[model samples]
Target chain A: MSAEIEDLLKRYQNYPNVVGIIILDPFAIPIKTTMEYTLTVHYAALISTLTSKAAKMVTNLDASNELMNIRLRTKVHEVIVLPSENYIIIVVQNPGS
Target chain B: MSAEIEDLLKRYQNYPNVVGIIILDPFAIPIKTTMEYTLTVHYAALISTLTSKAAKMVTNLDASNELMNIRLRTKVHEVIVLPSENYIIIVVQNPGS
Candidate 1:
C-alpha cells in the first residue's frame, strides 16, 4: 500500500498543472506530501476537516447521496480533494499556467 | 440590505440549473434559504465552514492569495459556494439536468 501510494503521488506530481500533492490520514495528518512540511501539514488539517464536513452534509441532505470531490478555485491556485478509504489526496494546481 | 439580498437570491434561484440556494451569516447560520428548514440549516452549517476554512487555506498558502469560490461536486449535486464580506451564498445545481 505504501508503494502504491508513492506511485500515485508521483503520478499526480508529474501532471502538467499540478503544483503540489499531499496524502493525508483519517486524522488529517500528512502521510506524504510533495510540498514543504509546514505547508503540507496546514493543508492536511484544513482540507480534511472540510472534506468530512462535506461528506456529512451530503449524507444529511439525502441518505443515498455521497460526496465525490471538492474543487476550490483561488486567485492563484486550484485545489482538488479526493477522499478514499484510508487516506485523502489533495492536489494543488495552477490552472492558468 | 435585505431587499438587495432578496433580489440576489431571486436572481440566483432563476439560474438554469440551480436547485436550491441559501444565504448564511458569518457564524454559519442560515439567513434565508430556498430549500426546507432542515436542509437549509444543514447546508448553512457545513458549506459555510468549508468556505471559511478554504479561505484561510488560501491566505495561509500565500499572503497575496485569496479564495474565489468553491465547487463541490457530489454524486447527485454540484454545490457552488460564494463567500463575501457580509454573507455566503450557496447554490446547489444538477449539472446533468
Candidate 2:
C-alpha cells in the first residue's frame, strides 16, 4: 500500500510547482509524506479534520454522491485533498506555476 | 456587487463543463446563483460550512498564510470554493468535459 502510494505521488511531481505530498488516515495520522519542508502533525491533524468534515457535510446531503477531491489554494500555496474510503491524499503546490 | 459577481461568473462560462456558480455569504445564504439545474440551499449551507472549517484549520496553523481557493471534485462534478473576506464563491463544473 505504501509503495503504491509513493508511486502515485511521484506521478504528481511532474506537475508544476508541486511542493509536497502527504497521505493521512481518517484520523489525520500521517501515513506517508514527501515534504522537504517541515510539516507538523498538528498540520496533518487539522487538515484531516477539514477533510473529514467536508466529506461528512457532502455525504449528509446526498448519499449517492461520493466525495473525490478537494483543493485549497492560498496566495503562496494550493492544498489538494483527495479522500478515498480509507485514506486521504494531500498535495501541496504553488498556484499559477 | 451583484453585477460584478454576475460578470465574474460570466468569465467562468468559458471554462469547460462549468454547469453553475453560486455566491454565498459567510453563513451560507445564497446571494447569487447561475445554476440551470436545481441547487438547494442545504447544499450551499454545507459547502459554506466546509469552507469555513477549512479556512479556520489553515489559519490555526499559520497566521500569515491566507486561504484563497478550494476545489472539490467528485466523479461527476467538480466543486471549487473561492473564499474572500466577506463571501464565498462556489463554482460547480463537470469533470473531464
Candidate 3:
C-alpha cells in the first residue's frame, strides 16, 4: 500500500503547481508525506474531520453520489483532498500554474 | 452587489467544466444562483457550516492564515467554495477537461 501511494504521489508531483503530498488513514494518521515538514497529528485529524463532514453533507443531499476529491486554493497555496475507501490523500501546491 | 456577482459568475462561466454558480450570505441565504435548479436554504446553510468549521480549524493551527477557497470534485461534478468578508460563492462544474 505504501509503495502504491508513493507511486501515486510521484505522479501528482508531475502536475503543475504541486509542491507536497500527504497520505493519511481514516483516523487522520499520517501514512506517508512528501512535505518538507512533518504534518502534525492535530492538523491531519482536522483535515479528516472536514472531509468526513463534507462527504456526509453530500450523501444527505444525494444518496446516489459519493465524494471523490476536494481542492482549496488561497493566494499562496492550493490544497487538494482525495478520499477513498480507507485513505485520504492531500496535495499542496502553489496557487497558479 | 448583485450586478457585481453576476459579472463574477460570468467570468467563471468561461472556465472549463463550469456549469453553475451560487452566491450566498454568511447566514447561508441565497443571494444569487446560476444553476438550473434552485438551491434549497437547507443546503446553503450546511455548506456555510462546513466552511466555518474548516476555517476555524485552520485558525486554530495558524492564526494568521485565512481560508480563501475550497473545491471538491466527484466523478460527475466539481464544487468550489469561495468565502469572503460577507459572502460565499460556490461554483459547480463537470469533472475532467
Candidate lDDT (C-alpha), each = 0.86, 0.77, 0.78
Write down the TM-score for model 1. Answer: 0.81
lDDT of 3 at B27: 79
Error of 2 at B56 (Å): 1.3
What lDDT would candidate 2 get against the real structure? 0.77
Tell me each candidate's TM-score: 0.81, 0.84, 0.83
- Residue B97, candidate 2: Cα error in Å is 2.9
Model 2 chain A: weakest 10-residue lDDT segment is A34-43
Q: Which portions of model 3 miss their true places by more than 4 Å?
A: A36-38, B13-17, B36-38
DockQ: the better of candidates 1 and 3:
1
Q: Which regions of candidate 2 are displaced past 4 Å?
A: A36-38, B36-38
The total of clashing pairs for model 3 equals 1
lDDT of 1 by residue, A1-97 (tens): 8998898898888877998999988788888888998888778877887899878878887899898988889988899998888889999999864
Q: Chain B alone: TM-score in each candidate?
A: 0.93, 0.86, 0.86
Candidate 2 chain B, run of 10 with poorest lDDT = B34-43
Error at A78, model 1, angstroms: 1.1
Higher-scoring candidate on lDDT, 1 or 3: 1
Candidate 1 regions exceeding 4 Å error are A10-16, B14-16, B25-31
Docking class of 2: medium
